[model samples]
Target: MQIQSGFLVFLVFYTLITLVLLHAVYRTSQLIVDEEFHLRQGEHFCRGRFHVWDPKITTFPGLYLISASLLGPFKACSVYALRLTSAIASIVNAYFIFIIRRTVVGKQEDARVLLESISLAILPPLYFFSHLYYTDVLSVTMVLMMIYFSLKEKHNYGALLAFFAIMMRQTNIVWVGYILGWRALDLAMKLCLPNENHQYRLRDLLTTVQTLLGSRFMFVRVIKLIFSSYYGYILNILAFMAFLYWNGSIVVGDKSAHVAAIHLPQIFYFTLFFATFSGSELLTLLPRVLRLVRNRWYITAFGMALFAWIVQQNTIVHPYLLADNRHYTFYVWNRFFGRWWFARYLPVPIYYGIVVSLAFLLFAQHNGRPPLIVSSLVWIVATVASVALQQLIEVRYFILPFLVLRLVQPNVRPSRKLVAFEVAFNLTVNVVTFYIFFTKEFYWSDYREPQRLIW
Candidate 1:
């Protein structure tokens, strides 16, 4: 009865949030930079000229096609129609989060699942994107569904959803790689060494590698593993190549803007974002991390070195930040400490240290379980890889990485205090951000103007 009542309350909460977003459909008349291009792309799609490839286009046609199809009838209300599409996607995303958590933990975690579902729904990042007409919400929803089906061992369905996800956002190729790589690892372990249990640690990988090296006809086994496990990934890659062939290039937007250029600073930024978004999980792990590094003089020495770097570091602005850096996170950080070299830079190194220390601590704590350790490491790798490949910084890029924390950290029911803090923080940010979106009017006379108003 308690579980039923909790789910019932969640439904009411979900419905109320959804209704509020829907109410803003017409009122939020502003369009960010990407939206203008997507709206144009949708117009092109509506006119039957499907192959509207350009040097500045980096994304697939899935989003534009989706918007055009939905807006076909409501031509006059296209903007509202597009926003409505995102609003509906938000609700569906919340449902998937609920179902996935329930599937993972089973019926025993009814209340916890409800809490997590609500958390996912109201997470400041997801909530902010839920109000816009961009592809972030749709791509994230498909990615979550793909992950859910993959966990359920529904490979075919997962692959299909993955294909759609990549279609929505090219960066999602990492997810496809993650899923297929995991399967490959599992298969190689099973075939190469029958006696060993599957685990995700270096020891397991080393064991598999050493066994293959020592075995007769080792090359044949390696080939067999590749052939057996990589068929799905290969198919997706081929599809992506075909998409590029038809579109004239691998990316749809400005190649310079979207290309995979390595930026090391992203490692620091993303780690902090995850640590912050993970909220109390990292907080609760503080003791474990301290204990893990407590006696290591080298760690303490490195900590001091990191501290020095933080104090000396300065804000590194790229073309993106210079245009408009009005995001709440940036705004708040800058307002409080951005002016001071150490104050602004301090958080970056601190976040990096916390994430690295916590990860090593978890590994030491769970040394015997390779599968648990390895699966999480895979997401972290994907998170880093995704950000490293980006040309610019944006909070929305962190959405998938933030979601991947579910796989990284063990599922712990948030304490009442943590829950309250998250609820209050996300609610405040979303309400304020949405208010800006609803009232702010867009004028294309200056590109930087919109950036100052949003974020």
Candidate 2:
């Protein structure tokens, strides 16, 4: 019965998505923004022109190759057909979220899980890209599939999906490292003695480390365990290194525009981004925040100070951010964060609050379990590695980290009311953003084409 209901929910949502895609295709029949590059590359693949490459495209050809496979039967790639690739990938992503939720929650496969899956599937930032011909949707889908398979103890399949994810975006190799760390931690927990208090303490970890280092035989055994469990991930990492060596950089093209840098404020921006889309849940964290301030006021104060310093020193306004009015980020930066000197620092407290709340939630969920703690730490490292060097302040970059954080915390279920609010919030944002994209048109002086606002 639950399965039937889940299917019905998916069908309803899928129908809605299809209608949105059709309308978007009809209105924006010509390629827009990155679609011009993506569609042309996909068309190149469709024509079997493998050697011809676009100098502007930064990622690998995974999106085009996958779209070509699906469009092979028709022998042509239309605007609608290319956009359908991501639209369909979005549905598959919803299914992967559902299964990953079930896997994380163990036996609790209730209606709420289905609702949570659908909520995440239609998250405004992610869902917005589904109507366009961009790599974000398919890229996110592959990563989610990798996480799902990893949770199912299917590391080999997970690694394969991770490869596909890397092909979609070179930076995704960081996530592969995250999975490798998670799998290694899981193996370490299994090898170590069980904790009596059900909490992984510092002493237990020290003892485990000592035990592994105490004997060459034990060290070899642990090494064997990692190799047996995560050899596929190791191969993926090695292949990625080879690609880096051959290509001379992570990006395939447009190297000057996508150069890496120390953008520490990006993480702060991510906290605010998470808080915004988190709906009523952010408000619910206030009580915990108060308790934290009462208990660890010094730590809280230091974190806020650090966030302020990062914002003061490391806020980056990319050239594209200032030049492009077509993205919502342009107005967001111009109207808010970039408008005044204090404006950038204004969100520092919110960032600190969200980070504290997230830490509290993580500790509460894991109860200091070593594997889960290590996994959380691994995710943080992966997220920082993924976005800290990104020169552009793109919200789409936050999608994978946000989804992975939610997926890893299966025990943290929002109230049904909150869930409903989230879904409504996402739908409302999608409607408004798409409406603006279709209705609001301005022309660039340099290009003769009309530009529309988009996420």
Candidate 3:
């Protein structure tokens, strides 16, 4: 019965997504924004032109290669067909979400798990690109699959998916490292100190590390365990390093525009983004947040000051961010943060509060085990590595991090009201974004094509 209910829910959501995808294709038949390059490259692959490469494209050719395989039977890669790849990937992502939740929390067929999975699958930022030929949907799917496999102790499959994820986006190597670390910690806990209580505190982690390092015999055992279990992950990292050595950079092309930098404000932007998108969940945890603020006022004050300094020093308004009015980020920057010189500092408190709230939620105990210890540490590192060096403020960059955090945090069970609100909120955003994209077309002064708003 549970399986049937889950399948039914998935089917209903899938039908809705397919309708939206069809409508999007019918309305915007021609390529828009990044689809122009994506579809063109996909067609190149379809025509057996393997040597051709697009200089403007930064990520690897995974999307195009996958699309070409799917379109092989048709012998022609239509725009709709190419777009369908992401839509299909979105559905696969939803399944991965369900399985990951089941693997982590052990409720295989809970209705709450079903709702959460579908809700995340249709997250506005990610759902919007499902009908477009973009890398975000497929990239996220690969990463989620990697996580799901890793959690299931299938390191070989996880490593293979991690490689695919990196191919989809070079930045996903951070996530690959995160999974490797998580598995390493899991192995260390089980093999070295199985009798110890798994409290997952900083001290516990330190003790575990000290014990492993203090004894050469235990250290050798852990090394053998890692090599026996996680050799695939090590190979993946080594290959990535070799690629970096050969290419001299992570990006495949367009190195000039994709330069890495110290953009500390990106993390703040992500916290704000998380608070906004997960508002219902945060609201439910409001009392906990208030208590945290009341108890740690000084830390909160220092955090706010630190965030203000970062915003003042490291806030980057990329050329694309200012020039691309089509994306929602432009209006957000222009009307909210960039409205006045003082406006940017206004959200410092909010960012600090959200960070504290997230820390509490992620670190809080559940059933005698920390919600996340090594995973949370790895997530912070991976998130910082993924976003702090990025010179752009693209919301797509936050999708994987948000999804990973939401998935691993065992306490993120939305109430019925919050679940309803989350679904309604995401659907509303999707409707509004799609309506504007289809109906409110204007022309860019430089280009002859009609410009439409997206994201």
| lDDT of candidates 1 onward, in order | 0.67, 0.80, 0.82
- Expressed as tens digits, the lDDT of each residue in 1-455 for candidate 2 is 76647656785767576667656655674667778899899888876787878999999899999977888568868777777788888878877887787788654446667767777887888887877888999999889999988887888899899999998988889989999987786577557655554345446666777878787887788889999889999999999899889988889888989888999989888887888777655665678778887798899789889889888888888999998888889998999988888999888878888888777655554322333566777888999998898989999999999989877763545677887788788778878887787777888787677888777
Off by over 4 Å in 2: 107-109, 194-203, 366-371
Tens-digit lDDT string for candidate 3 (342-452): 999998888888988788767776445467787888889999999899998899999989999888877555587787688778778878877787788878787777888
* Clash number for each model: 11, 0, 0
Greater-TM-score candidate between 1 and 3: 3
Model 3 — which ten-residue stretch has the worst lDDT?
A: 363-372
TM-score for each model? 0.84, 0.94, 0.95
Q: How displaced is residue 25 in candidate 1, in Å? A: 5.5
1 versus 3: better lDDT goes to: 3
The TM-score obtained by model 2 is 0.94
Tens-place lDDT per residue, model 1, 289-356, is: 66656666587668657655643552344565544445555555456555565565556547646766
Count steric clashes of candidate 3: 0
Error of 2 at 119 (Å): 1.2
TM accuracy, model 1: 0.84
**Candidates ranked, most accurate by lDDT first:** 3, 2, 1
